[model samples]
Target: MNKKRLLAAAMSVLVAGSMLLAGCGQKDVKQAGSKPEGAAYKFRLAESNPAEHPVTLGDKKFAELVKERSNGRITIDVFSGAQLGEEKAVLEQVQLGAIEFTRVSASPLGEFNKQMSVFSLPYLFDSEEHMWKFLKGEMGEKMLNDLQPSRMKGLAYYTGGARSFYSVKPLTGIDSLKGLKIRVMQNKINMDMVAALGGSATPMPAGEIFSALQTGVIDGAENNYPTFVAQNHYQSAKHYILDAHQRIPEVLLISKVIWDKLSPEDQKLIKQAALDSVDYQRDIWAKTEKEAEAKVRDAGVTITEVKDLKPWQAAVKPVIDKYSADFKEALDGIDKARK
Candidate 1:
């Protein structure tokens, strides 16, 4: 069999093993639902990235703050590297209260909250500064609060920086994208964005990206500097373009089912800790992203910077127009934030 099929079969077996383990540990995991009054509580936090990634660092920091603030009454174990499951499966577990918490990209979240898909729309944020402005204001809080209906609580937004196309093939500019099969998240807007840019979109889980690139199953993928380096996609995809197509934020979420069981005081404490962790995460994220770029360059990868986003932006205008009506409020808010 070819490498792509072999990798897929291996991952399938691993996922099955993880599910079997979860089944055996269901009783212990469900204990998170029953917190005794004024007693110690132990829970799990799922992260798909490696333990050393910035988001995982944020997850650990958040857990540390929670433990310290709770005076040892609350302790969280972080399961990184998809030890629990992939993003979608872990999200389902969180929704069912089987998993207490998870840190996931905003892309997969569109499945639960349609409003989330708005973030995946191309060029939605003029810059990272604009994104933070929207995320830290009323609109951001509203977006978080809106998650109650989905059985999840959005605590705070972690910086994911900008996502650009990286490929095994050299990407000179927008024209280089034509005929390339780029892997994208399973979000429709993301798929549409790639299609509008003249490439075929191959939707797959994040875990499958590295192998897909190595095996020629996909020619390119889009993501931020930290992710391209952290996930080691840079190793296989030697060309990086600074298109900054989308700046989707990663969210820290907890199961509302477990959250509702906590005392209001505890809830307040946890939320505050999560918010504080974002500040810590942002500091490291900036540094890590810079270092990531330098590291990849040292490895002899070609990093292309786009001089004019006007053409790229113009190309995806149809996609923007198609989704404009559906996300009028979000688009309007984003527009207002740019100033």
Candidate 2:
């Protein structure tokens, strides 16, 4: 072969090799960005309520938002009424990346992150406005960020409704609560608050509550009007006392593992959807409370709105002082929020 012809053949071979490598890189990129087949990204979202509850409404709305935003690239399977497990169990599943999402009351989260106890503090928030202000303010953002190290990402705060007292016997004043058995969330602050109010706190699961109330295992329980009515606790306990003591907020969370796997665009979509759903759920919650009150009233339950919370506040002040040391930052944040 001549020298010029040999050089031409070598150049042609190099060009062909370059084209093959470029083609492979393009194929890899396409594959990496492609959607999975058969199912969209399967996400298991669990909650601590039945499908008919407002919690389920929020879950369903979130799923619809994700599906719509992603054009059906993400599909969330919602397990309500503790089907996946209790709130604590589901939260652990989320931390381990075994579950994609969950809605939990901040009470149980206090065990994992003590800072969350701020939400458990009795009478910390003076009103619903104050509660929302603190939740959407800088303090709320800080509290939400506090979950990152625990491998959970907070999406939004849903209204759990104001905590109140209910009993088989009418509780007209703080004095009437003395020696009564009241079911509370398994949190130290809650136990202390019940004790301060002169009632014996019985920590139990929501699923076991109706049976407990029926069999006289517990004299009564405290929850929002909607919960008291929805759970049919009105049938077992005829008195609904509106103490409205602690306005505990329910937290919606996503697994950090799942969040990290998502594209930035997808993350933004999910976050926005969550925030929007909060507003929607809050509206539904208020209406639900009214309906619940009416329903229970019709069911022969006596509903009493406390004329003053000063006595109740005075009773639980010690609990605040005790838990305050561990939650100094949160207390400061709440104070700043008030200002």
Candidate 3:
């Protein structure tokens, strides 16, 4: 009986030791990612791009990193393909704190922060490297900080390559675009840019473009390569002119309402995650653009490269002049950014 009692006591002690070791392991994992004594945070990110889009993939990567770095303290849920609503409507929701985040083009974002329209200015970026150098510098930081008053915070920028003209007929030069009715975003800058380039700018909804092109309601529309192929716009419009106009950066925005609620440490974690996602998205953008260009050509679209950009650049001079007053600071940044 004494021997049996001794064995039972030894076994009980060993079990308790193992249980304590297991608890310590859990504590270490929790400490790596947990916020200090707070409830878990869950955020929703809205994206209008398609599910397979690089933007969407980047959004997922951001969420994944946040999860890993936070040690499960915070989780970000992404809603893609405009699952929330249109950009303008969703932006309003973000301001109201009904939504937490969104990925928006600099064009529609102009409605929230007017200076953002500067990104839509034609011929602003000489090359991708030039644009990125500016974006990763103080000027871009100011642009992001500019959103605070509007109750949003700019997190990061992702590329969608450059916009160009696509038509059922060839757009070989500035003269070739004359009298052609081209679809532009429903924005003053975009409209004026197209008009200055000699195309009759018709601002319309993106969804209407395919049928409109088919029925000859409009001559052509302009967008990036992925959009041109994904929407089957290549089926209706065979000529894609690579003028590389308007290389706008897409911005990731967070609701200030939600941001204010986060712990400083958590905010830092999220911001770093967002910045990391930018590189991932850019790589995806390059790959997607190359594949998109190939697919559209396989579908028999004629892709035209602009040999002389001097003529194209000269055409939008009036547009730069017209918005010179309101966006002067932004315009100046563009020139300075080139350096």
Candidate 4:
């Protein structure tokens, strides 16, 4: 009986030792982005423009980079053409964490973060180069960070090219815009800008702009060249005035709720990917802008370039001066960037 007991005890000890050794040999996988090993995460990105648009393409590139860097651990699905919602509605969804990501015009964001309205000021940047320099610098970082309080985090800025007025009638100069009803974004700064320029402001969503112009609900609207072509606004509003008034950028944002849940490493990785995609977007945007200009001209659309902008600048100076106090820091930073 004693011999049998000794043999049984020895067998149990060997089995226990083998189990411990097996565990030691196993690799440890740290949880990333609150996800477990072999588990993948999927996110949705909201883009109001069509798939072919530069901003949408940029978002896709960002997703591609993230998926490649994460080795299939993370994937993002982009819903273009406002499949998720219009700009404002999508932004609200992002803030509530109902959606994961979105790329929206910085103009509309003024409703959420007052500082964002600074971008809407007429002639804020001396040139596209000046605008990009400011957007990629420290002040830009602060402006992006300012969205945190609104329950969203700004990821990166995409080029909006230059915003200009296009109308059913010829927009020859500041005098041409007088008394015309201009469609503007749903923000006070844009409304005020239209008002300051001596035009009646009609606030509406992007999707509604084409019909509004066709039905004579609005006389004109202001946006980048790419938007004018992509949205087919040039079909109805045949006159484009190249005043290059505002170069408001489009901003990518993630829900703060979702951002807080991501691992620090994952957050850093995603931000770097977003920043890298900016170059891709900017390149395509330049090419597209040129193509759009040619297309519009070929379509018999009247193109008016204001060589002397002093008159237009003077006309909108009151709009800028009125809001200067509210955005002193931004204005100061912009001044520094001009140099």
Candidate 5:
């Protein structure tokens, strides 16, 4: 072969190889960006309700927002009514990267991060304004950041409403609660607070509350208005005392597994959507509480609005003191949050 002809053949071979490699690179990029055939990137979200609750509403809204913002690139499937199992089970699944998201009360989270006990403190938040300021401020960010180490990410806070007292008999004042068996969340602060308030605190799952109340296992239970009405505990415990004791906020959480898989742009979208949903849910919750209070009142349940929070606050002071010693740093943060 002539030398020029041989060089031309070699150049053609190199060009063909370069084109093949470029084609493969393009194919890989396409595969990475595009969804697989007949399959969506299903994000499994779980909550402990049947879609009517505020948390479920928030979950549904979050899914809708993600679908809209991602242009259908991401899809969230929510499992409500503990279908994905109890809150603790779901939380463990999230930690192991098996589940995508959940809305959990801070009580169970207290078992994981002791700092969460701060929220369980009775009378910690003075009012709705004080609660919002603390949660949307630096203190809230710090608390949210604290969850990262546990493989959980705090997205936003949902209003669980103010914890109050209800009884089979009328509870006119704090003294009326003396020696009564009051059902409380499975938390030390809650137990102690009820005890200090003159009720014998009984720790039980919320699901068992109605049965407990019905069977005289517990004479009363403390929770927000929505829970009291939704769970139908009002039938048994007709007297609703508006002690407004603890304004504990429910937390919306995402698994770090699903979070880390998100692109930075997608992360920003999800966070913003969650914040907006929080505000939306809070408004809905406030309205719901009003409706619930009115409905329960019409059902012949007496609603007593306690004026003297000082006695309630004074009673639970030892709870604060004990927690302060055990959780000094968190207490310090709460003190700063109040400012």
Candidate 6:
């Protein structure tokens, strides 16, 4: 077989095996009912973010909400900071019902669902509101439900905020990125986005970025304000530019193994709790961005906001065109959401 077909076939086998292992038996949706005395099931939810990160806070809120909604019968033990394992490993365990839950950036999720790459594509959404409108709308719902075949059921999406470019030196515009080695998630789309912007894309693990910046292993990296500051990456890469490239949403995923085994009533409650937590998480995120930016400035970081992003957008047009060919329908759905 050719490489593409072989890869697709391998993915199919992997997903199919996972489904059988996870007992993928989804039932028709039922109307929400009052919380029951519930089967006292204790499950695990893993997160890689720091304990104080908004994503972790959202997980805590979801756990709290689930306990309250279930009257404490269904307990979720939340593991923060990769106490379990890295995201890909936790995801594997989750698929096999070894772990019950996880919250992750939609970027890694592209490994499971290629359509998810749309999120990693630069400048896909015009604004944060536009991104949400697409995510919370029909196409978004379809994407969440689509995870079933992968032995994953996406419960809801939380705001991860926009990722921007930060460098050891100041970034003036689209031209500023030329030939700089920028760290990106080890994903093709992300790499392409950086390359399209005229930078050499260096894919590396999140854990290694600080050292990479400090030791000149990389020239800079892109991420949200809080992450840039929290990692003390500011000390190494002092220039912060608000190109706001990718506003990739965070995904809350449950094991289809665990999900299918749940009583439909329990499933409804879990979904409700997760959806409710989205608003709470977004509120925390807004306050956090401001707080992180202020603190970075206080630490003597040069922060630049790109009000006119036309040049930056234009630079990544090829990345957009390439994905558009493969994901035209998906791209159109997002465009529709813009209205």
> Which candidate tops lDDT?
1
**Sort order, lDDT high to low:** 1, 4, 6, 3, 2, 5
The CA root-mean-square deviation of candidate 5, after full C-alpha superposition on the true structure, stands at 13.7
lDDT of 5 by residue, 79-152 (tens): 88788777766777677566778888888788777787788988888888778878887778778779988889
lDDT, each prediction: 0.88, 0.81, 0.82, 0.86, 0.79, 0.84
Clashing residue pairs found in predicted model 2: 49-81
lDDT of 1 by residue, 1-339 (tens): 457745654564455446534543655444534443353567789999999899899999999999999878678899999998888878877776777889999998998898988899999898889999999988888999999899999999999999999999999999999999999998999999999999999999999999999999999999988889889999999999999999999999998977887777778889999999998999999999999999999999999999999999999999999989998888888888888
Question: What lDDT score goes with residue 21 in model 2?
Answer: 41
Give the per-residue lDDT of model 6 (tens digit) for 1-339.
Answer: 357745554574466456443442222212112335534566779898878888899999999999998878677889997887777666777776677899988888888778777899998888999999998888898999999998999999999899999999779887889999999886799999999999999988777898999899999999999788767899889898989999999999999987887787899899999999999999998998899989999999887889898898888999988878878877889989876
Full-model lDDT, candidate 6: 0.84
Model 6, residue 336: distance off in Å is 1.3
Residue-level lDDT of model 2, residues 1-339, one tens digit each, is: 357745554564355335434544644334423433222365778888778777678888888888887778666878887997888767766776667789999998887777887898888987898888889988797888789899999998998888889998887888889999989888888999999999999999888899999998999999988888778889989988888888888898998876776656667878888888887788888888888888999999888889988988899999988878888877887887777
RMSD to the true structure for each prediction, in A, is 5.9, 13.6, 14.0, 13.9, 13.7, 6.1
Candidate 3 residue 234 Cα shift, in angstroms, is 1.3
Look at candidate 1 and tell me the lDDT of residue 30. 45
TM-score of each model, paired residue for residue: 0.89, 0.88, 0.86, 0.89, 0.85, 0.88
Off by over 4 Å in 6: 1-36
Task: Please state the error at residue 300 of candidate 4 in Å.
Answer: 0.4
Off by over 4 Å in 5: 1-40, 326-333, 336-339
User: Least accurate stretch of 10 residues (summed lDDT) in model 4?
Assistant: 21-30
Candidate 2 displacement at residue 77 in angstroms:
1.9
